[model samples]
Structure formats: structure tokens, C-alpha cells
Target: MAYSIINCLQAAQDGVDIICLSITPNRRPSGIATFFNPIDMALLSAVKAGIFVVQAAGNTGPSPMSMSSFSPWIFTVGATSHDRVYSNSLCLGNNVTIPGVGLAPGTYENTMFKLIHARHALNKNTTVTDDMYIGECQDASKFSQDLVQGNLLICSYSVRFVLGLSTIQQALETAMNLSAVGVVFSMDLFVTAFQLNPVPMKMPGIIIPSANDSKILLQYYNSSLQIDGDSNKIVKFGAVASIGGGLEANYNNEAPKVVYYSARGPDPEDSLPHEADIMKPNLVAPGNFIWAAWSSVATDSVEFLGENFAMMSGTSMAAPHVAGLAALIKQQFPNFSPAAIGSALSTTASLYDNNGRPIMAQRSYPSIDQNLSPATPFDMGSGFVNATAALNPGLLFDSSYDDYMSFLCGINGSTPTVLNYTGQNCWTYNSTLYGPDLNLPSITIARLNQSRVVQRIIQNIAGNETYNVGWSAPYGTSMKVSPNYFSLASGERLVLSVIFNVTNNSSAASYGRIGLYGNQGHVVNIPVAVIFKIL
Candidate 1:
């Protein structure tokens, strides 16, 4: 691994502009921490060589404490749904609506009914009442027996409420417990629920109307038997595509709206322990129920079940959409640094929701609709990422490899060890304290005494305009530029290489700067800082 890191660093130094490190692989713990480990050494070498690393925030979720590698240097991203709804299916008016059963205790009325029936029948002599606690179940078999005896069952729709089990599995378990010939559920809780026929039960499992469930439960308590016309009144609802269909309500089937499952945040209010200081999900993108590339043999899909390339929800899916967009920006602005690119993307995002109102931060229950004042830093870093705006940002900042190195070593003033970069190849240095030699944390770049090589590639837009490139190093170091003067024909490309030699041993830990000066006073500045071994 150490040797691989060295080789990778050399390649980067030789002008490999972007390196994507998949910190984690499916079915295994992420390798992200390895990159942060002091023992790895290669990570530091990479920073010294100057590389931008983007990482996934990890898939662990539904908990307040779960985090990815949680390092300041790495850009961590979480998942969100592409759109709010799942697959669209036509629901005939006569079709049964299954009120999801066995859901969490605080589930909607429709869900509560199914839970009551499932629990009552399984428990035999025990009668289910409206106030029965659904969360108290510890035995699936005992619950199943109760469900078999009762004509109805209720369950929660969310994975966390269901205790990490699939809804279908829970339904089947309920059916087996109850010896009843059929089942009924409510639709108020889950808009995405589907009906599966031949549900592997001696009795048929079906969803009913929420109104019907309420009526029957009220009458059953008052009279204790079947309510007339309950079974015949259930109907299925059709799926509608809302957002990505285009700015208008007209369904396009091409683009959908952002999904509800995506994680949202107001920037962290207080940097308390166990909480993030930075607000995330800077912008929303396609995530909910999105169909995308997947492992060839993975069984995560609903239709193919175990087949590769399936539809999934969560911010995880939304993150890659932005990553792909970032790739596009790099292609357009070859000279832009990663930090600049981040800035352009963040600053040019969209702020309004489909309904034209500002986005809200409320995330749960009846009070979930309360709206808070919106701030660019709070609701969104800038706005939802706009690829076009990023591609043609009016003003661009260019950063060289050295600037990033200073950032990694924590010598950068006042800013956290991890810095947020935006603009066109531009690196922005932020600090909490102000003043020269400011007690603020500062990032400084330095050169090593030994021979070092660095390469950079600058892509020309429109394949037009001939330009000349030059370089300079900080006062204490000397560098030799290869092909010091090169012509980049309109719609052409140029690659430059620079070799440096440090003045002395002290320079090994000294931070300095490097500049790439071009025509029209276009300049890219890079800070070079060396890592200090505390021991």
C-alpha cells in the first residue's frame, strides 16, 4: 500500500490532475480511515504532492450519531433520494389498498389498524385496542399467531420503525400468525406500498381504506363483528411524477423532482461534541428512487431482487449526480482548481423549491411543516448545484497543488484543518482570527531538499487562443521549468512540468508559495507546507 501511494503521488506530481479514491467498497468497511491514519504516511505524501480527494459519507443512517470517516481533510457526502416518489403504477379504483401493519407505535391510523389485527389474532385470547403499543413486540411468531386470528393487521412503513426488516417480510409473518382467510391495510401511511399476489399465505393479504379501517375499528369495539361494505370500498391510487418532469407539473418521465428521503440541514448551530460544525447537503439533486449503475450481481433491486443495476433512494444516490457534474466542470475549465470548482458549484445553486417557497428544515411529524428563516449558509451553502453556471462561472480562482498541501498540514491560519474550496480552480483560505501572524490557523507550503517533480495539464476551451505559461517558486527554493515557453493553439492543450530543489534541511518543514502566471494577469497561486512529526 505504501509503495502504491508513492507511485500514485509520483503520477500526480507528473500531472495527473484528478484522482478519485473509492474509500469504501460494498459489503466491507470503508478504507477512508486508512487514508487518515498517521501510520499510512502515503496520505501525507499525496497531500505534499497536491491532490484533491472526494469521498462518500458512508451509508449508515437513520441515526443521529452515524458518520463517515469524519476527517476534516476529506469531503464527505451523504445520500438523498433522487425524487420524492418511487416507481409509477396504475391503481385500479377497485383494487385493495393494504394498510401497512406492524408499523411503529406512532404510525398513522391506517397503519395502526393493521397492527392491531395482526397483534390481536397472534396473541389469541388477548384483544387488540386502539391504544395497544405496537413497539412492544419482541416475537415475530407470537405476533404472527395473533395476526392469523384477527382479520386485520397494521405496521410501520419506515425501515427504522420496522426494525431494519423489509415490509413484505413483516406482512408475510403477520399472515402466517393469523389463520384468517384475508388481510386488510390502510394507504394513509405509505404512498409507495405495492400489492403482491400469491403472498405465500393460506389467506389472502390485502390493503383496505383508511376510512374503512377507522369505521370498522369503531364499530367492532361497539359491536365486535364485520362492518358492511368495508371490503368492497377499497381502491388503489396511481403514482405521479412531480419534480423531475420539468419545471411544470406536466409529467415528462425524463427528469423528476428531488426526493423526500434526501437529508437536509441548517448548518450546525452549535459545534457541540458528536455533532458536525459544517452544514451539509449543500444542494439537492436526483436521489429518491433513482435508477442507476450498480454492481452486476448485486441483489439490491426490487424487481430483479438480486440483479445488478437497481433503483435506490437516499442522499447516497444524489451525491454521485453532483460528482458527475463536477467531472463535467473539470472538463470545461481545465485550469480551475478543485477548491475553485467547489465554489462555483456552491455559489450558483438554486434556492427555491418547486412550489416557489423557500426550502424548509422541518423533518418530522405534525410540526414538520414549520418554516424557518432561510440563509445561504444555513439552508444551502449557495444553492442547488447548477452545472451550466459552474461551467461558465464569470469569475474564477485558480489554485495550484501547493496550496492544498499547506491546507492539509493545518498551518493555514484560523480555518479548520479541513477547508471548503470553491470557484474556478481557486483555493480560498479562511480563518477565524484576523491580523498578520494572526493566532489563526494558517496553511503554509514548503519544498523538500531532495529532487522533486511536478506536472500540470491546462485544457483550452473552444480549441482557440494561443497562450504562454510561466512559473515561479518561493524565495527559499529554486525550480526548473520544462518547456518554459509553450504555445497552446486555439482549441489545443498544454502540459507543463516543474522540478524543484530545496535550499536546506529546515526548508523541509518550511511553508512557501508557487505561482503560475499567464497572459492578462491570470495567475494561479499555490501554498506549499510540509508536515511536522509531533514525536
Candidate 2:
């Protein structure tokens, strides 16, 4: 934390415009909300000094309650993608071809080898170790060398996707150890990560992400002509390759959606009962398969040379895009505070994917239910970052150091006592001011079982005009904003009191959005999530 703080401070002191952090503390299982941990505290402190902090909402998503960087002061980012995928096609022995991805360049011509399925290789035993099945191509030494030698081996990839070459390489090493001519690994999930296309195929292999491809290959392996009155089954395979690549916003998908690995929110802080109803991941950007500059240092690790760029996927890639967008926002509004800048970006961001459907995120990592449900503000925060639209956001959800300080005093029994609390007494301010009432553009209730009013104030940065209120309440919850329609002059402010009345039918937690609209596509979406709990 100290090291991160020092670097951030130094950069700010050097007159750096923005701080985009792609790194985080790995020791902790999840991110600390605001001041509970050193890094978040340091970042919150830095934000107070007008240093815009754009961070990655860790890549542990598609899982419930897995999010980091929930601090309202920070602009947390999530990743999204399109249908565009890097294709590496492979030809089968039956003159059939299937799409695949590999790092090996060129072709591995007709070199026939008998196909061997992992199920057949397993020792004939009624009971076997778990690793015996999962470790087929993963655990090379376990294979029957005499039976596998010079044959094309088919194995299942151990995880969802290849996180790195080291994982796939391990499987390759196993194939090599068994004297197998090559291997055909199948992926359990579709990932937009890069596939290498290095020449002289590394261990002569190819990878397919579809389960159907595995079934097709298995069928062929089960077909063989009887020879010498002996019913025999043997499959022949040929020409294998590998490649590298990634993708985001193919702009061709039925709808734009958050990648499965992108972190989500309801702010993990909701783990505590009656805690702050704070939503996180302040924004979203195209992070998958992003092409950027890479290390040029010559190394034996990769198969190709003279390549100084690569297409990669992850939150790290997404955060920098936000950083650049933040820098651009700063360059235009040189006098705006960090919070104001963030508000502008969020307030004017885009909400619809290419298909005109609301932005959606995957339900869970291993889910195949393709009809993805709409993404809540928890997953998308404001929306997709729009550089031009952010230049002039009509209204700003502005807050100051004092307001945040008051917030610190109101969270679940105050943030952390060590946050310069000795200088200021928590009782001096509205100890009643909870975390969600920090003058943000959104409203939330960590636990809502009854009717209540959420106080909020919006500043009109645009010239005197009439802006109407519109909203979508979560199921079983009725909500309304007092003073629904308001007219404000330039540099004026308006207080819109929001009320949420829960219904007895309310069961599980619900999430929805409320939008304030003006002409010329000016829309401010406020997210509200009510944790249905027995009070």
C-alpha cells in the first residue's frame, strides 16, 4: 500500500494528469471497500487530492458477490466484448474441417497418425482417482506410453480457458513425454483471449473451444474397419497448428455484453448486514482482445520473433482505456475535480449494445444459457464509456472532501478509525448520513424491507431547461422521485427526493435503473438494488 501510495503521490506531484492502476494487492481474496484496507484507503485519500483513480474491477466475475474497488470515489471499470474471434481452422482425416485457435503459424501437412481418445487410455478399473480422468493430457506420466506413441491424442483442457501458455504447455509436455505425435485439446468455454500462430508448431497441437467438435472427433475415433476377422476401431488424424489473438465489441453480436470474467458488483460490502448500499464498477469499456504495445525483448518463450505487438484480454487492458479516456476528460475540463469528471463520464455513457438491447453480463462462469439477462448498474455501473458524450454532461453528481468525510463517519460504524479521525469527531456531523447518501448519482439499500426515502441532490450544469424524471423499479418494489420534473438555471441545483416502498411479495434481491433524460441523448441512469432481508 505504501509503495502504491508513494508512486501515486509522486506522479501527482509531477503534474501527471490521471492515475490508471492496473495492479492490485494479490494477497487479499477480494478488494477492500474504501478505507477498510491500506490500498483502498490510500486510493481514497488520493482521490480527495483531485487525482482521478481509474482501476480494474478484478477479473473474478460471473460469480456472485465477486468485486473489488467498490469505493465511490474511484472510477471502477469492467470489460465487454463482441462475437469477433480469432479463427485457426484445422482439417480432419475425413476431409472435415473445424474452426480452432493455436499459436503455430503455417500448416502441418498430411502426416497420418492413429487417433487415441483419453477414455480408452485409462486403466480398466471400476474405480479411479479423480486425477486419473482430469489429468489425462494434464498428467503426462500417467499415460500408457507404448499405446500412445506416435498417435494423435485428444485431451480436455483442465480449466475454463487458457489463462496463459504455461497451462497449455503443460499438456503439451505430457503429450511429448508419451511420444505422441501431437495433441488436440478442447476448451470447456469460449474465451476471447489471444491464440498463438507461431511457426513450427509447439509440440504440434491445436485447440477448439466447442464441445460439439469434441463429439465429432470422438465419433470418428470410434469408427474403424474390421481386419483379419478382428473387429478393430482406429482413427487417423492429420495436419495440426496453433495461433495467438483476442476480441472485443465485434459489433456483430446479437447484443453487447460484459465478458464472463469481468468483475461484478452489489458491492461485496453487502456481505455485512445493514451495511452501505453502495454499487461499484463505476464504468465499462471494451477490454477483451484489445491490441496494444507489448514487450519486445527477445526471448525463447514465444515461437515468433520481430513482433512488438499482441492482442490480449483482461481488466488490465480495460483499465488503461479508462485511464486514457479520463486523461482526455481532464484535458477538456481542466478545472473539473476528479469526481466531477467521473460524473460526466458516467452520466453521458451509453447503455445499449449493438443489438439495441440493454447491456448484459453473463450469469455465471460455467453457464451456457445464452439468453443473457440484462446487466444491472452493479455490473455496468454508469455504462459504456463515451469519450465525446462525456465532454459535456449536463448534470454532475458532485461531492467534496467534507461530504466524503461525513460519509466516512456514516458507513458501517464508520470506515476505519485510522483515517485521520483523531482530528475530527464523527459525532460532529450527520452520523446518520449512511454510505449511499454521499451525494452520488445513484441510490441503493443494502437491506430494504420497508418504505423509505433516499435523499439526493443534482446540480444542473446545463443551461436553464426542464428535465423530466423516468425510472424502472425493481420487482416487488415501488419507487418515485419527489419533484419529478424540475427546471433549473445554469449553475443551479435541484433536490430530488427518491422513495422506495417494498412489497410483501419481494423475495430475493432485485436490481434496476432510473434515468433522468433531456434532449440530445442526455441521460443519467441511477442504479438501485434492494437486498431483500427479513427485518
Candidate 3:
């Protein structure tokens, strides 16, 4: 991993403006004490080289502190659903339509085929007793070809499938082997709720996840069943269903939402027991049901075996969206530093959705019952990225190479350690600086003992503009910014001090924002996060 990071850094040094890492090499380490591994140190080197870096926050989420990208210098991104979706429906012969998910072509429109469960079509010759092999259809040879041919095979969705023991590919192959026209996956009854990611299918398919819907399908199938009266009941398949094409994209007016699997954070850790005074997932972007380029040889998904395009979802996908926008910023502002570019994106991000309501985050695991609430700094660092606003952000909080090195020093990074990674000795600065003192677009004081004063520097880049500063204090605290209103000409910089006083000693983190409304139609927002802890 370290070697790969070095290769990427070498590319950046060779003039790559932006680097998007959709891959997470170390996702288990939660705290800052164990954060800066060799891979992280390598990324720090990349950031120091004046390259803008964006990394995925990781997919193991809705779990706090479950982030892999922990460096304060690296811009992390989380996933969000952008109002577009692909829906598939199953129409039973009885005219009951049930919504489901899958990426595959449908069978002949309105053409119903016989429906038979995997258990009902078992071959008399095989002796396999495992539920996965029988009901889950892991093995095609265990099912009779004569019984399944020209029918819609009903396969069971199991926990094994979630654990990678069983796969949709296996089920699709089983259906093909049995000459079935289409496939239907019934949700696992025991494990009522689990995230069922859409899988690519060459054949017509649908996964019914709702318990009520699955019960309806089951009841309908049973009613259509014909049993010959004998000492042993012989079954005749009568249930029929038509699969709808799910490949069509549907765009709606729905607001973009932080996805369930996108990792959340209150940063991570500073060194030991204290949390890092940094906002992770610098922002959120479109990542759900994204249609992107795919490698033809990649065996990641069976449905896209030789296809050049596929629909996928993850924080990995979200990072690229930010990386692309960063490239645009670089093109427009050739003199902009990495920190300036980052600030542009952060300060101009939108906290509200198209509906004018606060953006929401998926607080629970993926299930039919979607649990959501308003997102916070920890859930969505600044907010959703706004490309147009970012291109014209009037003011930016810029940091330099020395500024980052000082941040390392403030985090208790030793002089020799800093030299080893960045080839810079912290002793040269001969000053005291804390991690929270860095002039970042956002402010986070993980541990506020009584109170602390943090400083920030903002440079006017758009025009000579007068601005009125406004702020909402974080819960349990009171804050006041020095010189509430100030005017700056182009290329002029001003220093501001924020004084925070603890009103309530609460361990829970508080969130707020500072708004800089300018007369030149420029608005910059800085997010504030802190925890008021009494000694």
C-alpha cells in the first residue's frame, strides 16, 4: 500500500492536479493514535506536493469512527443518493405489481411464465440437504431441468449471499442451466432486514425485499399451486409472473441524501483519548446508482462480465465527483493552492436540498424502513458539493506547506517523524501551534476545556466586497467573532479570532455555522463543531 501511494505521489509531483482514491487500504483503524500509517504518511507527502487529494470515507458505515482516511490534509468524501433511481417491478398473473431492484433486462413485456420455487423443482437424483443448495439455488444440478424449464425460478436470498458465500451470479447461472426464462429472489425470512445492493444480471431478475410484499407473492403462489391427491402430494406449478425491465433510469425531484453505507465521523482521534479537531468527509456527492466506466475484464460483477459500463454505488464513487470538480477549479484558478481549492468547495457547499430543507443522512443500516434525520458536520462535513458556487467562492481560507507541517507538529508528531515523511524538520518553525489552529474552511475543537480562542485567515479573491459576519453558536457554547463586519479588496487577507465560551459542560458534540454574507453576491459558510467537556 505504501509503495502504491508513493507511485501515486510520484504522478502528482509530475503535475497531476488532482488524485481520486476510490479504494480504502486500511479501514479498521479508528483513532488518530493509529491513523497515520505508512499509507497515510505517503498521502501526506502527496498533499505537501501541492496536489489536491480526495479519498473515499469507506463503505462500512452508519458506524461511528469507522473511517479509513484519517489525515487532516487529505479531503475525504461520503456517498449520497442524487434523486435518480432505477426501478424494477414484478407483475403477477393476478395483476399484483411489486417493486424490486436489479440491473437487468426484462422478459417479454406482460408475458407471464410459470413460477416454481427451487425446493419444489428439486431433482430426485441429488441428495444435497443444505438450504443454500436447495432453496437458495447455489447448485443448478440439484434441480430437475424438466420441472424448471420455461419457468420463473424462485430462489431464496440468504445471509450467505450477504457474507459472499452465495452469489447472484450462481443463481443466474442456475436459472440459465435449468432453461428458466427469468429469476425471482425471495428475501430471507429469518434475517428480516439487510442491505440488498443491486447486482448486474444478464437474465431477467428481481429481488423482493419487503416482508409484506414477499408474503403477498408467497400467498399468491400457494393459491395457484395444484396438488395431486395421493399419499404423497405431487405438485403442479401454476403461479406466473412477468419481470419488468429495470435498466431504465428514473429522475425525480427527490432531495439528495447521505447514503447509509457512507462512513460518518467526528473526525477520528488526535493521538490518544481526544478526538481530532478536523471535519472528515470534507463533503458529499452523487454516488448512488451512478453509471460509470467499468473494466471489461473485472470479475467484480457477473452481470457486467464483458460490458464497458456498469451501475455502482459507494463513497468510492463520491470521491471521483469531487476530484472532477477540483480539476475544474484548478483549470479556472491556475494560481490557487490546494488549500484554496479545498476552501472554495467547502465554503460554497449547500446545506439544504432542492426542497430548501436541510439535507438528511441515513442514520441506520440499509433496509426497507429508511431511518433518516438532518445531517450534521459529522454526518456531512460541510454539505453537498456545489460546483457553480465553488467556482466563484469570493473568499478562501488558504494554508501553505508550512501550515500543514505545523499542523503535524501540533498533533504531537515528532520532528524526526515529520522529517521522515515530509523531509521537513518541525524545529525550524520554533513556534507553538495546535491542530485546531490551522486555517481550515471548518473549525473543530474536539475537546474544549472551559474555552479556547481559535484564529482564521480569509482572503478576498472575487472583488472588493464588504461583508457582514453572522454566526450561530454551537450548542452548549457561546461564540463571538472579532470584527463582525469587514471589507477587503481583491487579494487582500484578514485575520479573525473566534472566542468560544462553554455555557454547558456536555460531552456530546455541538454543531453550528458562521456565515459571511457579502454585498457582491458572495456567501461563504464555515462549519463549527466542538465538544464542551469540563475538567
Instruction: Give the candidate number with the greatest TM-score.
Output: 3
Q: Which ten residues in a row have the lowest lDDT in candidate 3?
A: 266-275
- The reply for model 2, stretches above 4 Å from the true place, is 25-34, 91-99, 103-205, 210-219, 222-251, 267-269, 273-276, 298-306, 365-371, 412-416, 420-429, 532-535
lDDT of 2 by residue, 288-319 (tens): 76666656674533432345765666777788
State every prediction's TM-score relative to the real structure: 0.46, 0.77, 0.91
Error of 2 at 17 (Å): 2.7
Candidate 3 residue 27 C-alpha distance from true site, Å: 3.6
Error at 360, model 3, angstroms: 0.5
lDDT of 1 by residue, 1-535 (tens): 5555666667567865444443432222233222233312344344334444444444433223234333333334444322233221111122322232211122122222222433333444344563254422323555545333433343323333223344444554545444433334333343332221111122333333243343443334334333347664213212111101111122323222322223332112212211232233334555445556556565443233334444555556556767677777777766555655554455445545555654333232222224233322222323455666566543332343444333333333313223322112213433221111111111222213365555544444333333343444544456666765555444454555656665444412333433444453333333333312221
Runs in model 1 lying further than 4 Å from the true structure: 1-52, 56-84, 87-116, 120-167, 173-283, 293-304, 307-311, 365-367, 370-376, 408-535
Better of 1 and 3 by lDDT: 3
Task: Give candidate 3 regions above 4 Å deviation.
Answer: 28-32, 91-97, 107-112, 127-132, 138-141, 159-167, 189-197, 209-230, 267-275
- Between prediction 2 and prediction 3, the one with superior lDDT is 3
Best by lDDT: 3
